[model samples]
Target: MYTKDKYSLRTVLLWTRRYIYIFVLISVIPVVLYQLAGWKWLHLPWRPIGLVGTALAFISGFKNNASYGRLWEARKIYGGIVNASRLFATMVNDFITNEFTENNKTDEELFLIRKTIIMRHVAWMTSLRHALRVKKPWETSGNNTSDKEHMQSIHIQEYKYTLEEELDGYLSDEEKNYVLDKTNKQTACLNLQSKNFKELKMDGLIEDFRHMEFKNIIGELFALQGKSERIKNFPYPRQFATLNSFFVWFFILLLPFGLMHEFEEIGISLIDSLSGNEIYFFIAKNFIWLTIPFSIAISWIFITMERVGDVSENPFEGMSNDVPITTISRGIEIDIREMIGDDKTEIPNPHPEYNNTQM
Candidate 1:
């Protein structure tokens, strides 16, 4: 995501530079041409321009409010994911009995089952993050958290690398095929974890009551994954987007003519010292040129803000303003491992070396 301090004059200028030619052609050149031809040819009533500007402003305000609502909703959905992930880990650690009962399964079996479920829970978080970002689960790499050794032992590396390479080769064929494959992998991983939990219950390593408790948490995690997918796939209405574009362009087009009427009415005043007509024309020329640049600058600001809201509404896109999904997944892994009697040393710390890498 963009830093909180990213909104500044320099940032605006940088964005403007990217679309400089278009702004000049649409907003600047016409005003300059009209000024050169003399202000008389451009004259139009100020009242109509004022009315149009007010209407455009109202539309822009409504659009911004609607976009922000979507953005907030997406953030709340991810918040649910974070809570559900923690709940899953907690249920696995606390609800399952470590000791064997009359059915005769050992503590070791129970431990293995719990650990496997925990790892799979971690995998689910990672998979969901990748899914929302439209990335393959295997494409991500690095020390997202401090527990590299445990992650490697679980075969996260080999599976990820192999799958990622295969995905990269297959992406050209059809995007849906690749997405379907990844989704299957996520489901398969969750199923394996669930099977391990069920086996423990059958063997009497965990009580039937405890097994059900953990299963409920797993169900919640599945629900959260579906919610994230909904946000990623569905977007705000296209008509709302079209409306905003139309109004912004209309306002720009009508501004120069609006100023022309004011100049014509003030024309007689210029003759007391100089020709009132010439003075009025000069005022009209300067105002029109000023309006062009000012309008372009304001439009750029609005466009940039709208674009940011668009990206933030689905924060899994690997864009600058997207949620740090990889980072969150790593945090879930570290937290689960630490809770399960693993030594703190075994779990990696957060905050890998930044070096020169861009976030």
Candidate 2:
């Protein structure tokens, strides 16, 4: 996610400029009809429009809260993965031993076993992250033309490498091919891990209780993976999203008509306050035009609120605002590999941030 202190006014304005153009037109059109065409009947009473604005605020608040809850839950699930991965790696390095084995193995043999198992876990993480990054029909950051244009300016590591190629770094050729052939490659990787873990149990390298513990960690990892996939596959309800957009635009379109009547009356009263100076009368009467900018600014506030929630609902879409799952996955790899005695130089470097976001 974005790690900056705050999004500056310039950044917020630039990000939302497309919507601003539409808001300007929505505000100005009614003003033009009311003023230039002398369509006084088009000016609406401010009270009903004010009521709609209030309802819009309540609805937008509900949507944003629900969307943010999804994003936070996704983050927590990955947090669980990070913890469970480290625990599993430590078990690989420490739990299995010659303590119960028929033939005593050398330190080198034990170390090799630890490294292989940790690397397999790393492969599982890789496949799970790739699955999360896959675009769903409801996601906007990678799907829409305008959002795709914006994303082009930012670099995502997953986009730089193919899933098959990346899996090669952690999985054997046979294992990678087997996984690639499956519908859920991550699930396949987990099955491979469980199979290897079971073999260790059968060989007496790990005792029965220790084997059970290892399976439990794997089960936790599987649960975490499934949670993330559920969020990625099942979208926030489209009904709430569709109607939120319509209602926001509907309120904005009607906003200027109500504002114009209010501003014009204020302009006329101000003109009557002026002492008979022709220039002052002209300036005071024309002040009604200030409603255009006011209307645009207010409409922008409501629209921006709606847009924030819209984009936040899908946390794995590789958007700059999404949870930094790729970065988190890489970090876990580094940690687990280091625990298994891999050289620091052999480990890949951390993912670099793009536009203040790590993804």
Candidate 3:
């Protein structure tokens, strides 16, 4: 969702700083114990460590791949929505006509008809985006202040206003009340649309063919809606996410124990080679502390990768890395309204980008 070329280094570091602290603790504690207490027994061979790293890499790669697929598919579904919406708007604007009607309406009345249908579709978009942004129990982005701050830096700007508030301008008092009463407001809106199209048919505003085509587009919208809902309601398998973390952490905690002795051996050889050089010996003997940074670096990489997968699995969670469906919805709204020939000044602007992300 980041529309900037990438997250700033400062932003990335700040977002990962909590996990970095854990890594620092995991790396530093064992090094201190080994150095100060002469705990030579703390040393571990590298082969088993290498094996764990290799296995963890494979699983983590799979997780990331699956997560990215979820993210990309969600985006593609919304992209479909954008196209279908424009097509629907164009069809509605052109198909409904006075040609078939015995009691023909003026062009102004027809414009109002087109406006009503398109605006209801706009309301549906509003409701859908609102539904998507609802926090699930498993979602990581919640009401925490710090994470909220970072997310808003690149999050959906439309999330600020209540959907109800936005719906007021788009729906009549009766229509608004009808929609608000429903469990799935967007689905309710679509049903209203279908009913309206049927009424338009009875009134001879649209012929049978146009009515069926409208119904077909509504069906596609339903399919897109279900696809998004499936992703939102169903989660990635928990066992894989849970066990991957445990394995990565186990390997990271064990890493310094395995590598510190190897670094110490290197230090010893350095001192032997530079014999009688007091400065070099001092530097060589203290080189074991370098393992702290090394271990921290390695741990950060694995943990960050795992976290990325975790967050990516839920694209509707309103995280900075989410799919930006709200943004896409707004773009569709802007396009559909324009295509229907709504007054340019009356239409709202596209949702503003956050840190270059159009969320």
Q: Write the per-residue lDDT of candidate 2 for residues 85-200, one digit (tens) a residue.
A: 88888888889899988987899998888888888888888888888877778888755655675566667666778888888767788888999999998999899988988998
Largest lDDT belongs to which candidate? 3
Candidate 1 vs 2: which has more lDDT:
2
Model 2 — which ten-residue stretch has the worst lDDT? 2-11
In terms of TM-score, how similar is model 1 to the real structure?
Answer: 0.72
TM-score computed on alpha carbons, candidate 2? 0.95
Q: All models: lDDT?
A: 0.56, 0.85, 0.86
Query: Can you give the lDDT of residue 202 in candidate 2?
Result: 84
Worst 10 residues of 1 by lDDT: 138-147
* Candidate 3, 306-358: lDDT as tens digits: 87898899988777678877767778888988898889998878777766665
Runs with alpha carbons beyond 4 Å of true place in candidate 2? 276-280
lDDT of 1 by residue, 230-349 (tens): 766776566776676677667656655565345434443443445446656576435445656665665575556554544444455444344555555666668777777665775656
TM-score of each: 0.72, 0.95, 0.95
Residue 32 of candidate 2: its Cα lDDT?
85
Which is the winner by TM-score between candidate 2 and candidate 3?
3
Off by over 4 Å in 3: 143-146, 152-159
Candidates ranked by TM-score, best first? 3, 2, 1
